[model samples]
Target: MQRSEMPSINTQERLLAWALVLVCVALLFAQAPHGGDFYWSDSPRHALNGVFVMDLAKAMPFDDPAGYAYRYYAQYPALTILFYPPLFYAISAPFYAVLGVSHETALLVVALHYLALGLGCWRLARFWLPAAPSLAFAALVLWLPEVAFWGRQVMLEVPAFAFLVWSTVAVVAYLRGAPPRWLYLGAALLVLGMYTKISVAYMGVVYAALIAQRDGWAMLRNRHHWWVAALALVGLLPLAVLTLKFGQANLQSVTGVADAVASRTSWQGWVWYLQQIPSQAGWPLTALGLAGAVMAAWRRMPGLGFWWLGFGVGYLFFSSIDLKEARHSVFLLPSVTFFAVLLLHTLVPPRVGHGAVAALALLVLATAGLTVWTRPVFYVQGYARAAAEVARLAPRDSTVMFSGYRDGSFVFNMRALEGRRDLHVMRADKLLLGVAVRRELGVEQKGLTEGEIADALNANGVHYVVMQPGFWADLEAMQRFERVMSSDQFEEVARISTPANHKAHETELVIYRNKGAVTPRRRGIDIELKIINRRISAD
Candidate 1:
């Protein structure tokens, strides 16, 4: 009411705003360098896309691997892949354009992912909270051990989340009688997400549901919405071009694969759902998010509530139908945290906004700081150290195999070997076979026994076997394959292991030289990596 008081109020608000921006920038920069590294990041696939785009940029020759827009390169949405390549490549283009391919450039791209995700989180928080609370919430999401850590990886999770949050703000604004940018941007981002991962197709379901609520059956009565949908479809054109040029499978085949998997494990859906809530939910975070979502539902904030419910149900259902992996839960995390923060702010009044902001900011900074400093010691540094030793010590022609190659293929593909091709690398099929067990039995499966493993090894012509201490719960079980290496394992040929990987089934990678009779030599090594889709397993 008073002139001097007004100035004070404005200054306070300005400080809050500046503080929020500063927090976001600081958190993002903390994850800027090696912080993005994950054991089995989907980075290789993202990096491959960057490579493809670079091919496009340099006017290098190219080919369409698949003709179907959504079915190419593993049934991913063509548009999603097309969308991120340019974004990712731009960050790495200068270095790669000069030095060719290097992880250094990938580090830069992942850092950009941090920045993008941070911006998106900031935008989304603004829609729900006051300036200080909103920014603090964004920082909280950014520094989440999972979020900050994986956000920097060469993966689509952060990018997909970034787009989702940006579009959410846009769409919610429009629904509140604002403008069309939200709807358009949201749709574009949704399409982008789909290309990044087929999991994003769930967003379409969310949108359709939202529109139906807003306009009733009348929503479908208007062709304008359909036109918008068509535009989104058109946005997928470049991906379509890529698919066609590459000779990829059509969308029908892609969905067929999904359908088959769903049909096989339709029964264990609920059990899988229960299992994920504990591990993937981030302990207290999931509990907090769920509690918050309930409050939102009770408070008539159904839009946000529905978003969480839909994500949780959709992700759980999808996980059940296929195989469940930690990474699959990535998209559901933001929604979980979003609702959690919503609930937290609601429970705590703004009377203590300054204190609350400080506490939350301190938590995030502390977690991020710990991760940044210790990540190399436990995660990246360990892997790098192990990989370096393996490269240096393992015979050049010795086939390198990951004892527990769950999702660890990315590390195997990129890190296990240096720039030389003399090393023969092979991943054990026993671990990968878990993917197939769910499809056939309608329940989660474990790795194979010794006899089954022997058959698998013989069939695949595995020359070197890697195992950790935990990999053999019963050492007597695997007596068939003589252990060539042990705790001594060739004098720390850097038994490459990751920190996040539990000691259970954690093989120290005993390089058994396959003393059993070998299969006849062929003209070329026929290496078939076992594939286990929930509905099917390729032997």
Candidate 2:
């Protein structure tokens, strides 16, 4: 308890914190996402968002980003840029420009966020738990299945939640009397998190409640809370306006689209996330986490307001949303780890000392680490090669029509072309079909008849017909288009094969050469945002 002893302990803690960070780096290098790491349907879209930014910067159209973005989307129809927030892309753009657009380059950004997740969680845990338990719990949480799975992929959730964690930690530190300036730091991080993904905005309610309760009328009367309002106007107001335009589907997922799939009133929305914890995080951590949550709430622990309120409010907020996915609940991991470490510290007999807890945690981490040390799955990357072939053989400024569930992947791969940026990719489903796939199928009348499809194809100067058999086979229009591709108008020139995608139908990408004359033309894009709850009448 001596003041002099505090320096040595603080130094040791600092060393341990950085040491844990170094371990994170080692983990990234040792088990980097390989073998279709970016093959998940949404993975490539995340990568391409950054590519769009990188490509835009190269064109130097700072004054005309909207025009540039439309051109970029015209070239590749599968970008989810504005649908998601712009921070992740904005941050990754420079790296993409420096490293060049590849999955490896995109994944490097994920690795950086992964390190932040570890260090941020550890820092947050230090506020609630002792040094040993804090470091151990921080490392232990990352070993959770969902955390590791998300952090490994080029996805927005990990980075988004990491920023939220840092923000939460900073706000709690300020509440604990760290300094008034922590408010600014916390506000800045929260804005980054919100700009990374709008979902992070939900937890703002929790932070607001804490600040209101803590500061009372004096917070407003004294201007202690002005930073958050200032940040919201500057950072969030514009994002909110832009998202209204580009992220309409994303916004609807909270209510109409969300309820259509899993009603907000349904137990499925409320329980699905909790059900995932046992499997997503092992049973041991689940039990410990539950116990710690109870303990923290009962004791009214130091950081209980932030951690427990986050858990309770986060659970209700996410569960009430009509759109439900396990990833949406990843923000709850910090609370889970906090409570687990709380009980872990409690169970550690003082006689045995905290060092024993540290050793035990390391032991558990070492064993659990073995399980995630090697990421499995062989290469499922034929889409990139198909893109190369399309860029190489297709006439300059021509269109390539791709029909498959992974149109985003192909669009992403095509964006990497060196000299053929003029070539455009049109998704067959969007071009020829006006059907709803989310919640339930609402098949409108035929999207396009055989003759209409052919006319559209010719009008758009589609010189290459690439498709995976069985894709949209149920649709009458695709069937009609299939007949068109099968007829004498197009000949099967090359079969670009790739690994079967997601264990679905054999995805040997069949590329057909159109016998008709190649006409280069510009045309308006037909964008079918998926969360449209209404049916589209056949044209």
Candidate 3:
């Protein structure tokens, strides 16, 4: 190849990269929920929090009187504030104000972030791949089900990733000697990423490793390195303060309360993530990524070692954590995709022609399409209709108990979306009931009998109960449910049944009204009766 031809090749590649990025952005927008609603149990809650932050920013009351009200057993009886980094909410707040705090508005904000993610991916890939292939690779990474599906939601996963990738690109530019300003910019972005989600802190580790690899101990002598560190510390101070204040509650929120128990350091967790990669990233991309990583490592490619390190360290760190989730490892997706693009570029020999390169690009697009096609469209369906029904049927200022696996969805939809702030939707699980009893009723009873629970519900002014079929799956819960049904203190009100779909579990939300109690609060009577029965049985 002539040296003069290199400029033409580079220009053409740059143009193709931009063109591919635009196409990916268009596809992402197309898949987003424009007019229709897509449901996630967590999204409405996050959306509500964003609106709350927006209100606070505007000097309005942070709490909405007409919003769904639930006692935060973890805190006080307050509007639900998802214990997450506030950056996503802070960013989405203005959109909430302009869009009237609807799901569509939240999704639109996410769509914008998705576009930003595409651009970030392109810039990050350009460090390794030529301009044209880098653009296609960016589109492929953006189109991955792991990215696209979450990118459309109100969750912080994609938003944090957007910052993390850009930070990565800026860091690369700095290391390559563009300017010291890029290093500072990278620090700021890392801080921003941490604000969005703490998981992005892994990038800091990757960045340090990259520096250590490039300059060894000598990199520490650079004044610019010290400046970046100081800037990052300053940026991360707010998050550190939040961590100190919230402590374990914030950790529990991110890892999930249930995961605190279920997650363990096991190969099973590692295997689970490994299995998700092929589906999440697509088989073709995963294979190519593996090949590229091996090739890059075999040749000891400069500045490319961080990609492998990032993936390896990220996978190990996340998988080793007690709380394991597929999404927790999503930070590695871009690294994997980057390596995959490199392998694809290497596959076509200079003599083998551009057709081979085009075929590889086509293969990536096809795999992305397959992934999108197979991925579930909604996280939880039929929630909007059920929420509307609750809003319509239930009396204003009445408490509605939700006894279901997906109670969060009901709580979010009824309160967050429908603006049914007058209704207090309580999850009727034993753990929740225990907390409610202590907080709302000033009772500290544990292991309350079914009758005792029923009495407490009546005394607490809980007017309606909504139970799904899955709620009755537990033997004890089912027994209690039957007892509640047979009691004269409650009457069935409404039954909402939604057929199982590709994305959502089949649900039967049964609403029951509390019939006025014929007797005084059972308080300690059931416990006494149980003690007496125990003695009698022993005799």
Candidate 4:
């Protein structure tokens, strides 16, 4: 290889990288949803939280009281705002204020995060690969199905990771003698990442390992590093306090008391995450990442070694947790993609014609771009229409019930779309389980009888019930639902059916109206009744 030819090769690579960046951006915009309908259950809830923050900031009345209706398990029903750290919501709040609180505005916030993710990954990759391959690597990472799927929605994974990658880049730069300021910047970004999602705290382990390998125990002696560490800790103090106070409440809010019923020691969680790698990261990239890790180990490449460590430890740590989810693998994707691209560069023989290599890279990019563009949008189409119907048909200020685990879409649409804060929207299951409700209604601990359930609904002034068949698939639930439907106390109001799709629980929305308030019959003679009978007999 001639030294003179190196400059020309570098120039060509730089041009290719920028071109890939543009292509990735174009694909993302093409795929983004332009409507107010949310695609995922959590997205609408998260967006509503942002709106909650926005309303509070502006001194406006909280627009959605239904958001506060559900109880976090046996604990008293409280606002849902505290379940997650507020960084993502805080950043999104202003967008809601300016753009108007809608799914489109929430998506705008996600798109900004998406752009940051791509740029952050490109910058991080530059530490190892040249300009061209680093940009190409960023494009490939962005095109991964998980990234594309989550990036298009208002979710925490992509936004949190954008800061995490940039933080990694900053730490690497400081270690390579960029400047002391880089270390502080790295520390600040790490704090932001933690605030975004607590899962990113594992990055600190990677940072510690990298420093130890580079300078043995001596790096700890550096005052600048200690100051940076202190700053990060101070930055995290508020979050630490909040977590200590509300951590259990937050966990209960999401998982509920059912976490106690589910098997926590099962090996299925570990297996599930292992199986996701091939689909989450395409098989081609997964294979390349494995090869890259082996080659990097053989060559003793410290940078790649640190990445492998981060990826391995993060994967194992999350997999060991009882709650298994594919989205948790998102943070590990950047490291995996980095190694995959490194392997690609390594395996491409220097003797191979430059034009051939260029063509292969372009081919991969084109295929990925097309896949992302054609990917199905998974919005709940029925909820928007159902919400509109409810607003139009149901009397203003009437209590309405939603019976499902995924009721966020309904709550979001009723409040955000219809702007109906006067309506008391409740989840039937949550209402049944809520301890406060039981105390208020003087209901029995053993559970409500079919008659008692109807009595409780009427007593609470619930005028309408929205039932979804998929939510009542369990035998007991279905039986209860049937009993409620058969009761003479309620009449069928409206039924709306949507086109069949796998994303929603039920395509049919059945609305039932309370006919007349019926006094509930006591199942057994109460002590008060017994006391009255004895007094009358004695008299």
Considering every candidate listed, which one attains the maximal lDDT? Answer: 2
Q: lDDT tens digits, residues 1-539, model 3?
A: 00111112366665666677677767666766433244555666666677667756675434742222122221112233434678888888888777676777877777777777878887777666666677777788777877777777777888888898899878777777667798788888989988888877877888888777777899889998898898788878888876655444445434544444335445565666777898788887888878888898898776566677788888776765666556777888877788877777777665656754685678677867876787645654565567676667766666666676565456556645435665655556542333321132222235567777787676645677777755434455455665775588788877877544343555566767788653322221111111111111100
User: Which residue runs does candidate 2 get wrong by more than 4 Å?
Assistant: 1-12, 25-37, 62-64, 258-261, 297-303, 350-379, 435-447, 500-502, 522-539
* Number of backbone collisions per candidate: 20, 2, 2, 0
Better of 1 and 3 by lDDT: 3
The all-Cα superposition gives candidate 1 an RMSD in Å to the true structure of 8.7
Per-residue lDDT tens digits of candidate 1, residues 148-226?
5566566666766666666666666655555566577778877776555545567677667766777788977776678
TM-score ranking of the models: 2, 4, 3, 1
lDDT of 4 by residue, 439-461 (tens): 22232233567777777677655
State the TM-score for model 4: 0.81
What value does the lDDT take at residue 497 in candidate 4?
73
- Alpha-carbon shift of residue 521 in model 3 (angstroms): 17
| Model 4, C-alpha of 97: deviation from truth (Å) | 0.7
What is every candidate's alpha-carbon RMSD to the true fold?
A: 8.7, 4.1, 7.9, 8.7
**What lDDT score goes with residue 148 in model 3?**
73
Model 1 segments more than 4 A misplaced? 1-38, 41-59, 62-104, 152-154, 234-268, 271-291, 299-320, 347-539
* lDDT values for all models: 0.51, 0.73, 0.65, 0.66
